[model samples]
Target: MLRWFLAVIGYLFFRFPGAIAGFVLGSLLDNMMGGKTRTFKTSFGPSPTVSPADFELHLLSLASLVIKADGSVSQSELDYVRQYFVQAYGKDRANETFRVFNEVIKKREISAQNICNLLRQRTRYESRLQILHFLFSIASADGRVSEPEVNEIRRMAGYLGVYSQDFESIKAMFFKNPDSAYQILEIDRNATDAQVKDAYRTMAKKYHPDKLQHLDEAHRKGGEEKFKKVQEAYDQIKKERGI
Candidate 1:
């Protein structure tokens, strides 16, 4: 679809050679995005689904990547991932998943791009955003989100097709910098009062817990956390501006 569209546009302007050039470029772009030639649909609703096992495995792969980002795996980070799975899934199921993770996943070389490509193809954009939040949670398990961990997550965000502003919004939830509030709202510090209000409403709707109803309870809870962060950011800004 992308290739054909680009080829047509190219043909209109520059004839057969342009169409060929556009086809090549479009094919590259399509392959980079997992070759899904379907309509580009990004909603909080149901998307092309991955099986539970596949989803869990991809998540563990991402967790493994984040753990090793700082050159050493921290026990606290490992424990955090374990606890999250156990809480989200029962101990029995979580243990079985971890068994496979330890024996198969951790032993192999993990590819962030491949895992993210599959995710971007199979999951909703909101679900991918929650995945970033979960990875950040693991990265900050030891208290502070290290520079290496942040960079690793940033790379994953790109491959996952998460926008930069949305990436920064989730990242801000884990840090306490002065601009954290504005970043959380995905807005500029110089924005006017009405713009601030509009951003808050937009973010509130984006992060609302109900948006993840099709996902598991764990993700719905993650959405709630993000929603609360948006609320907090808006309140902080309001208080500062005396609005």
Candidate 2:
């Protein structure tokens, strides 16, 4: 039934590039509904069981939501989103994904919380964490994350079941401040030097990019960026305390 539906969509859009987009979107929808079914076949084996394409769509949708959290989206936010797509999926695929992204952005009625819930249902914790990180990046693209944007992100995090501490840690990575370093390390400012060292080691182990090896390249890269921030925050705290 799914394949037949896709065939009809392909025929209807036969004269337009949307035919390809329809196919990809339909495949993703089928995967979401069918679960574990192979959407593509190859001589090498099977295509990556996890769909980066679907994940990319969710990421862009969330980004659009974050960009519009302040009641309007900026050119800088749009440009950053475009550059993110180009970097992750290359120019050709990015252009294709951008079409879907625009449609999502146009639907201002759709709740960001709803999108986050769907992501939570369909994705793993690590993948959802990466999505949150990307959303923070989008919100901060205009030099700072607005209060509304931060509130929306926090609400989305709660809906996604991301621990409050982890959400704050990810937020601190993009919006740095003196106290943000402590947040990133998940430690108290008044903690003893020994306790601070222990917290840093624990955070280092928890955020190590190696833990995300099972995910796709884009997610692995996100994890690596997060891990670097964790290290930087720990170093900053150590320097401040002269530990």
Give the alpha carbon lDDT tens digit for every residue of 1-243 in model 2. 664577568868783555666667787887676763323322234443435566677677777778888999889999988987887778999998888766866786666677676666666676667778878878888898999999888988998889999998898887757798899988878988988889889988878888767665666888898889889888898888887
Per-model TM-score versus the true fold: 0.80, 0.74
Could you give candidate 1's per-residue lDDT for residues 58-128 as a string of tens digits?
89889998999999999999999998888787799889888887788547788899999888877778878
Consecutive 10-residue window with the lowest summed lDDT within model 1: 35-44
What are the lDDT scores of the predictions, listed in order?
0.87, 0.77
Using TM-score as the measure, the top candidate is 1
Report clashes for each candidate as comma-separated counts: 0, 0
**At residue 243, what lDDT does model 2 achieve?**
76
Model 2 alpha-carbon drift over 4 Å, by segment: 1-51, 103-108
Alpha-carbon RMSD, each predicted model: 9.9, 9.4
